[model samples]
Every structure is written in C-alpha cells, then in structure tokens.
Target: MRSTFDFQPLFRSTIGFDRMLDTLESASRVTSIDTWPPYDIVRTSEDDYRISMAVAGLTEADLTITQEQNMLLVAGQKSEQDEASGQYLHRGIAARAFRRRFELADHVKVVSANLVNGLLTIDLKRELPEEMKPRRIAIAAGEALPKAMTKQIEAEKQAA
Candidate 1:
C-alpha cells in the first residue's frame, strides 16, 4: 500500500521547512516504487551509519556507489550470469540490475564500501563542518554596551 499525504495544509502553518516537507513527500513516493535486492540502513554510532545490502552472487566489479550532494546512490549490474545451455526445473535466485537511492542528511558522507561474502557493506560517517558544529557562544562578562545601542535599549524600556 502507498501512503499519500497532503502537505499543503501543513505548509500554511510553517516556515523554512519546504525542503524537509519535499524530502518526506518524495521519500513516501519512492518507497512504494521498488523493492528489489533487499537492503538495510543501520545507525552504528552517534554519527556513524552502515547500509548492508544482500547481494548474493555479485562481485565488486558489478557494484557502483556514489554520493551526489546530500544523496547516496547504490547501483549494481550483473556482469556474469549463468549462460549454461541446460534446462533447470526451478530457477529461483535473482541476478538482475538494481539501483537504490538514499536521501542523506547534511554532513553525512560515504566512508568506505566493502563487499565481503556477498554482502555489500557501506559505511558512512557524519563529519560536520567547523562552522556548522555547535560551540559555546561566550558572552563577555561585565562588558558595557555601546552608547548608541544602550540608548536604543533604554528608549525601548521606557516605552514599555
């Protein structure tokens, strides 16, 4: 089942949240579109993450991972398939091309990707920029306000 949410009413009550709303709406639309080659997104630590994909019968040469802006994409193409000239009673395993996209938050980046034992393990870490990271905003103790600024403050106080 697909979820359809109307965000127009929410927009009227909020500001500076257009990006977030758009991201959520887009995510809801994309989730219902595809479900091939199962994958899992796990948060390992406070700022670390890992995406493990079950890609059995796949190799390193067939997988591609890329990060564009705040988006992470994982695509795989089966380069080697069973080209045998025999008839099989039951064909079950799927070795097909797939493309998976993830909407990553700011500061998150792909640290490394390793394919071990048919599992594509992608590691990610959030390294916030110095300016974006929160720090102490120290207030100067006993510092007097400038004459003009103090005059404006006094005027506002008297009016109030």
Candidate 2:
C-alpha cells in the first residue's frame, strides 16, 4: 500500500521549500531497492564526509565517478576478461554492472576518490562561501549615537 501526502497546506505557508518537499514525496513511494555492491557513508568531521563502496573485482578502468551539480553518480562494470576467465562451479561474486546516485547538499564537493583493496573511497568536504559564513558585528553604545544626534540637534537649533 502506498500512502500519499498532501502538501497544499505546507505550500501555502512555506517559501523556497518545493525541492525539499518533492524529494520527501518521491522517497515515500515504493520502488525496487537495489542493494548490490554495498556501500557505507560516514561523517569524519563537522564538514567532512566519506563514502566507501565495495567494488570487488572491478579495476579503475571499470569504474566511473561523476559529480554534476548536486548529484554524485558512481557506476561500475566488470571487465570483459573477468567474465571469460574461467568457469566456476558456484558463482558468487556479483560481476554485473551497477549504478548508484547520491544527492549532495549545496557547498558539498567531492575532494578525491581512490580504489584500494576492492574498496572505493570517496572524500567529500563542505566549503561555504565567504558571504555565507557567520560574521560578528560590532555593537555601538548609546553614547555613540547621541554624539552624532547631538551635532544634528545643535545644527537644527541654530537654524531656529
């Protein structure tokens, strides 16, 4: 059974949240979940993240990683030599091609990707722009405003 949520009420009060709401609604729908080539997502620090995926039997030439806007795509395809290497009595390891997609937040960028020991590790870091970073503003005391106001008040009184 699929449950549908009405976002009319939220739309009336919220602004610039349509994309988030659409993501939530689409995630709620039922679909075939692919679990092949297991992966792990870990947060190393406040602004650093790591994604490790098990891509056994796949070499650097067999994999492709792309970062487009807010999406990260990872795909792997077994080499032709591996498929015709030998006949196995009991086939176990998955050699099928697979594609994975990850949604990245604004300011989050892929730093590097490395393949080692059947594991592909991808590093991510979030770097906010200077204008978006928090900044401290100096507060002025009452006397500071009065000084400027007093000059204006004196000028007006002289004119009168």
Best by lDDT: 2
Clashing pairs in 1: none
Worst 10 residues of 2 by lDDT: 144-153
Q: Model 1 — TM-score against the truth? A: 0.73
- TM-scores, all models, native as reference: 0.73, 0.84
lDDT of 1 by residue, 1-160 (tens): 5468888898999999988999878766744667888989999999999999999977888889989999999998877455364677886878779999888988899999999999999999999999988899998789786767344344444654
Worst 10 residues of 1 by lDDT: 149-158
lDDT of each: 0.86, 0.91
How many clashes does each candidate structure show, in the order listed? 0, 0
Give the C-alpha lDDT of model 2.
0.91
Candidate 2 lDDT over residue span 1-160, tens digit each:
5488877789889999987887787787778999988999999999999999999989999999999998999999988888888888997888899999999988999999999999999999999999999999998766543444344344544654
RMSD of each: 7.0, 6.9
